[model samples]
Target: MSTTISTVALGDDIAALPRARPAPPARRRPPLKLAALWPRVRGWLLAWPVPLAVLALWQLAASYQWIPAQILPAPLTVAATFVDLFNTGELQSNTLISLQRVLFGFLTGAVLGLALGVAMGLSPLVKDYLYPTFKAFAQVPSLGWLPLLMMVVGIDEALKIILIAKSTFVPITLNTYKGLQGVPSSYIEVAKVYGFNRWQMLRRVVLPAAFPPIWNGVRYGLTHSWLALVGVELLASSEGLGFLIVYGRQLYQLDVVLAAVVVVGAVGYALDKILALIEARLLRWRRDAF
Candidate 1:
C-alpha cells in the first residue's frame, strides 16, 4: 500500500511539472506567388530611383534652357526625333545593316579564336611559338590597323568586317586560353584515373570546367565587335546608325544625334541582357553541383 502511494505521488509530481506549450505553431510563410514577385518588385524599386532622378534633372535643365538648346536638346525632342526616324524606316534599315555586320563578323572571329585558343592551350610548343606575336598584334588597336587594312582590303564591306573581327578575336582567344589553362589539375587527375580518353577528357571535363570564362570571352567579344562596327561605320560607311549620328552632326541636329545615341545604347543593353539570360540558363548546373 505504501509503495502504491509513492508511485502515485511520483506520477502526480511529473504531471505538475511545466509543459513546453507546443512551439507556437510555426508562423506561416507568405503565398508562393507573393514570395516570388516581391523580389522583382523590390529590385525595380531599388533600380528606378537614380534613373528617374536623372531624367527629372534633365527635363528641368532643358525646360530652363540651362544648357543651349543647340547643344543639349530636350528629352521629348529626342524622343520625337526617334519616333520620326522609326516611322520613316531609316532607323530600322540602318539598325538591321549594323546587326548583320556584327553577327557575321562575330561568328567568324569566334570560330577562329576558338580554334587557335584550343591549339595553343593544348600544346606548349604552339603557345610558345604563337603567343608572343599574338600579344604584340593585340596591343595595337583596331583603328591602328585601319589604314594598313584599307590599303590592302580597300574601303568596302571587307574592310569593316575585318576590323570588327579583329576587335572580337583578341578577347575570345585570350579568355579561352586562360580559361583552359585554369582548369584544376585535380580534375585532370580524376579523369586520368577514370581512364578517360583524350576526347572524353576534353569533351566532358575541360570544356565544362572552362565554360564560364569562355562564355565571358564570347560576351566581351560581341561587345567589342559592336563597338568596332560603330567605329568603322563612323569612319567609312554611308548607311548605319553611326552614319545617322554623322548625318545629324552634319545638319547640326542635336536631337537626331541624341536619338541615334539612345538607340545605340538601348540595343547594346538589350543584346547584353539576352547574353546574360543565355549564360544563366547554361550555368544552371553550377548551382546544383554545389
Candidate 2:
C-alpha cells in the first residue's frame, strides 16, 4: 500500500511539471531559380548562330568543289545575283506585282469570308445551304484550279489574283464560321439577361470574343495567298518570284532559282513573324488576366 501511494505521488508530480512545446517549424523559402526563367527564355532571341553557321557551311561547300556550282550555286553568286536583280529594279517590280495580287485578292476574300461566315455561323439556314459546297471547294488543291481558271481568266494578272482569292477564301470562311460558332452559350445567356439587342450582342459580345480566331484565319489566308501566287506565277506568268525561278531554270542559272527561293522563304517568314507579333499584342490582355 505504501509503495503504490508513493508511485501515484511520483506520477502526479511528473504530470504537474510543465512540458516543453515543439519549436515552431522553420519557414521554408521558395526557390530563387524560378525568377530567372524569363531571361533564359529571352535568350532564345540570340540563338541564330546555328542557322548562320549552316549558311556559312553551305556557302563554303558550293564555293569549293564539294558541290558542283552548276547544280548548287555558291552563296556569293546568289548574293551577287540578288544585288544585280535589285539594282536593275527587276526584283522590286516583280515583288510589287506579287504584293498587289496578294493584297487585292486577300482583301476581297477576307471581306467575303467574314460576311459569309458570320451569317452562316448565326443562321442554320445559311450554314445548311453553303457548307457542303464550301467544303468541296476547300478540298480541291489550289493548283488544281489553275487549269480551269486559266481557261476563263487566261495567263494574266486577273487569273493570278482570282486564284489567290480562291485560296484565301476557304480557310478564312471556315475559321471565322468556327470561331463565331464557338462562342459560349453562357455568354449568349448573359447577353440575353442583360437585355442586349441583337446588334449590340453581335458588336459587343460575338465579335470581340471571335476576333482572335478570325485573326488566325486572316493569317492563314495570307499564307495561302502567297503560295497560290507563287504557283500561278510558276505555271504560266512572265513576272513575280515564281517566274524568276522559272526564268532562272530556262537560262540554266540555278543560282537565280536558289536566290529567288531564298527570297520567297524570307518573305514568308517575315509575314509570319509580323502576324505573330500582332497576335501577341492582341492577346496581351488575355495573357495577363489568365
- Candidate 1, residues 1-290: lDDT per residue as tens digits? 99999999999999999987876778898667978899999998999999999989989999999999999899999999999999999999999999999999999899989888888888899999999999999999998999898899898899889998998899999999999999999999999999999999999999999999999999999999999988998898898998999999999999999898888888888888899999999999999899
User: Which ranges in model 2 have alpha carbons more than 4 Å from their true place?
Assistant: 1-50
Per-residue lDDT of model 2, residues 1-290, tens digit only: 99999999999999999999999999999677855786776677567778899998998898677988888888888899999988999888888887888899888888888888888999999999999988988999888988898889788888887888888898899999999999998999999999999999999899889989999999999999899989889998998899999999999999889888988888888987899998999989888998
Task: Tell me how far the alpha carbon of residue 197 in candidate 1 is from the true structure, in angstroms, after superposition.
Answer: 0.9
Work out how many backbone clashes candidate 2 has: 0
At residue 213, what lDDT does model 2 achieve?
Answer: 92
RMSD of 1: 8.3
10 residues in a row with least lDDT, candidate 2: 34-43
Off by over 4 Å in 1: 1-40
